[model samples]
Target: MTLQTQLVLRALLRNPAHEMYGRQLADETGLMPGTTHPILLRLEQAGWVTSRKEDIDPHAEGRPARRYYRLTATGAAQAGAALAKARRPRTTALRDLAGEGGTL
Candidate 1:
């Protein structure tokens, strides 16, 4: 996965219950709205996130609706795995180096 997608997935996992709009995501990730929104749309297409229209101003008639996103169960699992893998140490490189010193 692209770093941008990974970052967005991680953010959703961190706040699974809270539905975040594109602008909120942009602010949190320090990414441009153009970049972040497309990633979110892709995630939604992949069934990783569910998006819905949110009415921010209940009293404002016909105000533009906001798109809110929440994580799916599959998404949660994927995000958890991604986060764990990101945190894991690079043991493969160390193992390869250790073999070179064996029986020396």
Candidate 2:
């Protein structure tokens, strides 16, 4: 997964029960709307996430209702696995040399 994808997935996973809008998700992930929206779309298409328009009256709120997103059961499991793997430490060249008592 790409960095953006990982960030978005983790953000959603953090609030598995709550639905978040695109802008809110972007804010939470420190990503601009341009990056966040596309990732949401792709995740929706892939069935990892789902979205729906909020049932609010625009006239009452004086603004358009927003779309909200949440992860599916399968998505949560997949994201959990991905995040676990991502967090694992990998041995790099520097680390390997250090292990062999070499200089940095």
Candidate 3:
């Protein structure tokens, strides 16, 4: 995964049970909305995330309805495993390289 993708995933993982709007995630991850939205779209398409439109009335709220996203139970488990793998020690990765006859 790209660093931006990792950042987005990490942000969601922080509070898997709490839904966040795209703008919230963009702010939290320090990524631009252009970058964040596409990542969210990909994650949603991959079934790693689910989203719903906020129930508030836009007219009454004086703003557009926000689309909230949250990690699904299965998604949480999958993301956790992926993040763990991504965080594995560099030494372990080097060992794998050596085993594969790759130079340091």
Candidate with the larger lDDT of 2 and 3: 3
- Cα lDDT of model 1 by residue, 1-104, tens digit: 67887778877888798898888888888889999999998888888899999757755766567889989989888778877887765877667767866531
1-104, model 3: which lDDT tens digit per residue? 78898898899999999999999999999999999999889999999999999899899999999999999888888988988888776886788877876776
* Number of backbone clashes in candidate 1: 0
Candidate ranking (TM-score, best to worst): 3, 2, 1
- How much is the lDDT of residue 2 in candidate 2? 85
Q: How many residue pairs clash in each candidate?
A: 0, 0, 0
Best by TM-score: 3
Of 2 and 3, the candidate ranking higher by TM-score: 3
Q: What is the C-alpha RMSD of each candidate to the true structure, in Å?
A: 4.2, 2.7, 3.4
Segments of candidate 2 deviating more than 4 angstroms: 89-104
TM-scores, all candidates, are: 0.74, 0.81, 0.82
| Lowest summed lDDT window (length 10), candidate 3 | 95-104
Selected candidate, larger lDDT, 1 vs 2: 2
lDDT of each: 0.83, 0.90, 0.91
lDDT of 2 by residue, 3-69 (tens): 9999999999987878999999999999999999999999999888999999999999998999899
* Global fold similarity of model 3 (TM-score): 0.82
Which stretches in model 3 have alpha-carbon errors above 4 Å?
89-104
